[model samples]
Target: MDRTLTTATTAKIADAATAGSAHAVGLAEWLTRRAARAPHKPALTCNGITWNYGELIERIERMSAVLAAGGVTPGARVGYLGLNDPMFVVVLFATARIGAICVPLNFRLSGQELAFIIGDAGVHTLVVGEEHIAVIDAVRTDLACHCFIHRGGAVPGWESADALMAGARAERSLPVAVPVRADDVAVIMYTSGTTGHPKGAMLTHGNFWANNLNEMFLWDMVSTDVTLNFAPMFHVGGLLCGSMATLLAGGHLMLQRAFDAEAVLHAVAAHRITVSFAVPAMLLFISQHAAFEAADLSSLRLIAVGGAPMPEPLLRLYGARNIPVHQGYGMTETASMITFLHPDRSSDKLGSSGTPPLMTEIKLIDASGEPVTAPGATGEICVRGANVMPGYWNRPEATQASFTPDGWFRSGDIGYRDAEGFLYVCDRIKDMVISGGENIYPAEVESVLYDHPDIAEVAVIGAPDARWGERVVAVVAPCPGKSITLEGLHAFAEGKLARYKLPKELRIVDALPRNSTGKVLKATLRVHNVATATGSP
Candidate 1:
């Protein structure tokens, strides 16, 4: 009896030890708990398919096992080049499960650019979507990775994702139990290179969880909220704010492969999407679509806009339609949103980026590194928060330089806070155009031009000028059936802009060059050797 009692006690102690060690707070572990708690809850809905929390967890487990079997161990870099498919989410969580870092390649990048990132990140495996297979094929010779997984269909020398998942089912296998710590680097998001080669921002699992918490707090997200992800999954705004936020709140996510204004409009109504995030340009396009007048938008309660300056007219339109436009501010370094304008203050605090979310501290500093305390004093915005990335991947010097001695990350954006503690962004310090002796912020000029009825899309960039250091130029895409002339722009901006802020040159095109997140690629515009004068300024 004594021996049996001792054995029972030992078994109980072992079980207690196991229970204590079982809980993990990594980005992916939250999903596992959600699955256990709400197995029947709709988790992801995309392309006519809906997966419940339980089924989604199973798929993620299978994908994680598949990745492990393919020699992807802890700390391995896995590159993904794909559209905004639900599979991307699976791959991301799978990477997190095995403690591997996911490097989501921007499909819009050139073959050389893609090769550079792949090599820099030391990626051993690449997963390419069907549409981008040719893009990978072009750069395969330069890529160091030997393993390729294709998502849509069979490709020579590429393992089919469908087949691999099927094999996992046939084998009745489970994911290898790899310990993933909260601080483990989950993703290395490459910055969109407006100046030079992109640097990878190492976002740890803790950073992701913090961002999700911020999203939940700011958006007041609930599990019943049906969210739509129209933005590209490769971008932080789409992945973090759109899908991940919903997943964190135990809400349903509707995924789109790509952004089509009509498709987004239809999906919102069809799926009863309650919340979404988009760039200013996307919001404009969707609002202007013909279906906007007919589509049942009663379900959409909140829409967050970012990535560019939000035009006042767009805000007014949403207000008129009884939908709230919440403008947010953040970058790749912060995972997603650091500051967001509340829906109630969208009109009253027009153009303000809003206050910093909980646990995020924001301060502005001048050139001499002195803090700007006075309200309305423009300074480089700096932030420190749990959501902020640990540092640039493999770039220690850059990482060190990004933060101040006090541990705040320099945002490089020139902005100021109002008396009410609302944040208003002026412009990017690097993007400031200096013509002769005057400092001209392109956003100010762009905002003025955007107000014009004839203009559909506008980007202000500084063109090289031997005479004036740099000349203010406007690259515009006119509204349908409307033509924009330099004279018309000058007349429209005569009173609103100063002489130096006015566009010295105008180039009308079919569309403006934009990044995946709808940010106008001003660097690309500067290289266009086209110049036309409607008349001498």
Candidate 2:
């Protein structure tokens, strides 16, 4: 019983990992507990189907037996390269039941991009979707995935997931051999590679348990609550936090394959979903969607956002609509949200990323490791918690450099904390654009540019320049039937930002390039060889 901590206080209890010997404990256990307590309770709802606790556990058990019969073993890397699905949950629990580590691959990644992650994670058994089956087949020669379980529909070199489940037993029929430990790696979520190739963040069982416990403390969760989690299952924010967080409360998860605003709104109303989590970009899409005004989104109690920042305008819009939106902050290393914007401070603290999660200890430190005491003094955001990942998978040097000597995981984000402890992110260390010896943050510029009437979407990137080292350029998608001159945009931004911070060049387009999750893919944009001189500075 956690003899590591001598205290029995509630605060210490808040940090305690769930009672378990191993980290990679099967979802079967969690399901069994809830089923025993309330068998009829809906555990998951998706695509016009609702699965109760007992039923979900039975499916997971069948899937686990299927995987075990297919030669899956302890420590085996089972990769789920698919979008969000109820089947993903089955795969997740089934992988854990046999003591295997689940590697959920992002479907949005290109074949080459996915190949790197597959090789890096040593994923030999890939359970992909029909959409990614061709990509997997194309890159199968180089990747380690020998056995593939294809969902969605049938494809060659892939066994049907439904067929496997049909043939397998619906109970834990195999003899227990390897024990699931609380510290064993449960998931290896690849970080969103904004800068380079994605690195696997090895999240142990304690990481998830801690995250779940911290979530209960920071947010209101109950067994009666139904969560409409539209976020992709491949991401830690979705799989670990969004999905698992709902499970921890013995609540229901309404699964959607992807974030379709009208669909999500329908699900929330249809399923009576009490909670929802999404990225800032998703929130923007939902708010901007044509059916926003007509949709009944009132069933949503707490709508949490993270992954990226939303401007204050969006916050006001959500608040006006009766959905209290709280912005959360974390990385793959923290399992999900090491910090979340509290409901109370959602409106009171505008542009703030809220407080650290109950189990987390956060500090802002400079290059010298000295703490920044001032409110506006931007420093690196470092987090220490049970929720924090042990290290990167198979990269000791990268892991060692990722933390301080004392155990804080160094987040490469520049942010400041207020006296009340709310965080205000300034910029990413890697994303900071330098022009003519001047420092500029794309977020700051982007936030200001977002306020303009003509702009639909805007991305500020550092363009390669032989003279200024890197010039600031704004690539924007304008609203339909509306246009803004490059000089006019400069004139609008000039007062809000410094001269170097203002976009020296403005390029209008039909649409801005975005990642699979709708995040502006700046790296891809930087390689865009389009240059047009509008009436600019």
Candidate 3:
């Protein structure tokens, strides 16, 4: 009854199987190995439908076969435009199975922005949800694609994924001929660039797997843990930290189309979810929900929050409610959580993003490019680890500028690590706002305001808000000899910036406070914007 392969035998088997096949360090193999070890374990559960490890692996293989049959090949960019669903997870693994890069598009992006990412990635086949069929149709001419697959239902000339998946035979794919290495690019996630465009960050399979292992190591997760993932799949935090981590751990994942506080709480109680990921906004809603006092949330063993800082009030609420949430910090360039504050320390640290994960190295560097070696110190945060992305797609200048000579990623955010290794972020080098837990780069907003004719000069900054965390505030200098009002400025930006980035308080003045050298000082505006807006003439 000894069915176990010895260590040497296992190594030999792996060497023989992966001899010429691409994806040597791939998650496809990970799924198979985990399935063989525990086939009955649940891998995904969405809207009451469940798939075990065995079933999940089979679906991935079949889907990959369908993709390959449809002409997807190694290095091809396959785009996915949908909300979070099991199919999104399936598409990720399927694309990786063949060494193709997965491009996850934001569902909320305008058709023009979506076109840029799809075109930038050179994606030829897009898999979108039926909800976006109209949106995709509007921009299909701009998408440099050959075909499309609809996730929810059928569309004209586009294959229906749900139907195809239902009819597709479940069988493991024949081994790929060439091995996909750890360094091979697995995904391309688009980040809003400084130049009013989006840049695709090329992340390898190793990047995704390494981050998963780091989180797994930090939390010491077990098979019994169930993670509820309501974050958007297109983002690194959602696909990697939320869903991918669950699959990598061979645990259970509960999927959501998007973050809905009531739905999230219901899923937790219904599935008895033990682990979960949420941003500060989602956590705040849960804290303020009517069910907060009634719902038995004791099933949650661990939680991680990111995309914004966890305010002191919210952190205290979770601690008092017996649901401690670890704060994590990272960006699209770094595969999800670069550093994590474990749940146990959620209450203790109060405001830190915890220490770097096991495989990651974090350093603080002064403006002179020298490392700051102690606590209560502030400097630009630099990270080096397997979880770091390979580079941006087709952006050599950006890739070169983003790193130090030695290889550490130079994060523009300023933070300091305590003696105990907890990271405390103070300010960002880039003028960005984390209003309602979403990144709002001021440059993007400023560009929107620059188009207004009445505005001679304008600057936007994040101002404190009691309810919304941070609200975008814009200050404008009226053109000389021309008259303009705050209401007029708000009307110009109403349709331009996203609702969250829309200026909450607008100030029209004779001149925006600027430095002597002619640089608009944002630091000065943050204070003056509040003072001047009190009584506008």
Candidate 4:
């Protein structure tokens, strides 16, 4: 595919985007407008099935009718539990069409854990993939959800998504897209919190639009771009970065259910994928795969990395292959992107998280709650932008505590800025762990393990891992005369916590180091364990 655009064409595309931004009220309207503009263009492909823009919109409208027929109304929460598939996108758009909120649950979570989020969100309708039906079934009795729709296959006591869509199509009439304002919530993404429970971040349609515009201006994504999406759609980085941006730009999407390093390489070569988003771990795995040296990656124009810093060695490896790695920084609250480092400066500003996006603002404040004006002064990173979420769902206290009185979102991250205004993140105030792009709150993991009979007292910390960016290390004071094994702890916490959040390394201490106020001195723990926090069973 030719990836060239003349000056006039570039200007024309920018103008079009600016004009569309003025009129597009929500995500549902974007698909309708795009289909009208390019009905025959391929929009999404997954599981050997391809859907053009025209067909895709029709499917969305049919799904919307199905949802409406099931009593789904504006402001209702609709949950989706699945991997990366076209139907996941369908549910997102379909929910947006009816002005309902889409709650994309992490498929990796345990059934009980999933129930808490579903109950907290008050989800009225849930759509589950076949692979996850058993998990949901185990917790069905505990949930107050009204409707359960299963995709991929039929299951007892569940509505068939395929059957519902077919019926809606046969009915010949589709529900009109609901009129929604820019500030209306499009998705309620749950982020694990320091309080040992997940908080749903209410991301508005305007937030998504702002992030999309930021990416379009920086990444220069075009309709000719073919993006391969293997990142889990449950995460904001996966849903809002390359996947939604590519669709908003009218590009083609090659959707994969999960990330497979070998498959990613093959797909990039065979399909000539031009743009993709991945975490550092995915990139590391891809570069280490046996096919890395032989795979053809000439078609790749940009590979965006987030969730963790891109190690310099991996950056050099990809740089040698002539593939530019665009490192970015953001969180679920920011709709996935805040600061973006263009590939041009990726090497020069090696450890920096780049500058704020076109419409985003980044500032650092010292411990005294004052702005740190001098370059290289360490402070807590704060953000202010249209792309930032308005607040957390139904958590007024959390919403208030997360923002300063002046309206800036407190990122709970410590970083410094260079003289050139580049952001360099150093530590997290909440001690959240980013293991392979998934956010794991140490408090949450510790809470689960505290219930273990063999564990008298426990504190979880993230230890540096070469491959996974960081590995969960459980520092424990075992019960008197009781020995705890890593396997035993894993088995104990198996159904209570997500597999990724499980302790990879266990450390036994006579007693955890604590300050006068009785808080665990995690810094001391990190200093001692980081060097030895290697090897996972």
Best by lDDT: 4
- For 1-537, candidate 1 gives per-residue lDDT tens digits of 011112332333234334544335576677766655566688898898888876676677778888888999889999999888878988998888788889998776667668888998999889889898987798788888968998955778889987887677512465554667667899999873333456899998888888888888888899999999988888888888767878877899999888899999889888899999887667777888988988888898899877665777777887788888788888889887768888788777888999998858799999988999899999999999888888998888889988998899998889999998899987676676655423466766777789999899988887666445467888888899998888889898875554556888888778888889998787778777544444342
Error of 3 at 324 (Å): 2.1
Better of 3 and 4 by lDDT: 4
lDDT tens readout by residue for model 3, 1-537:
112233432343345444444443576666656555566678788877888766666666667776776788899989998888888888888888777888998887767667878888899678988888887898787776976999766567789876766555443333352347888898999887776667899898888878888888876777778988988888777877756767767788888878888888888898898888877877888778888778878998778888887888887777777886778998889988678887777767877888888878889999989999888889999999998987899999999989998899988899988888789888889777777666677787788789988779888788776656787777778677776566676677664544665677776667777788988888987765334573121
Candidate 4 C-alpha lDDT tens digits along 104-179: 9999999989999999999999999999999999999999998999895567899999888877751355675688
CA lDDT, candidate 1, residue 339: 88
Question: Which portions of model 4 show Cα errors greater than 4 Å?
Answer: 1-23, 529-537
How many clashing residue pairs appear in each of the predictions shown? Answer: 0, 5, 11, 0
Minimal lDDT window, size 10, model 4: 1-10
* TM-score of every candidate: 0.79, 0.77, 0.90, 0.95
* Global local distance difference test of model 2: 0.74
Candidate 4 lDDT (Cα, whole model)?
0.88
For 377-417, candidate 2 gives per-residue lDDT tens digits of: 88999999888999988878889989999989998888998
- 3 or 4, greater by TM-score: 4
Model 1's TM-score against the true structure: 0.79
Scored by TM-score, the top model is 4
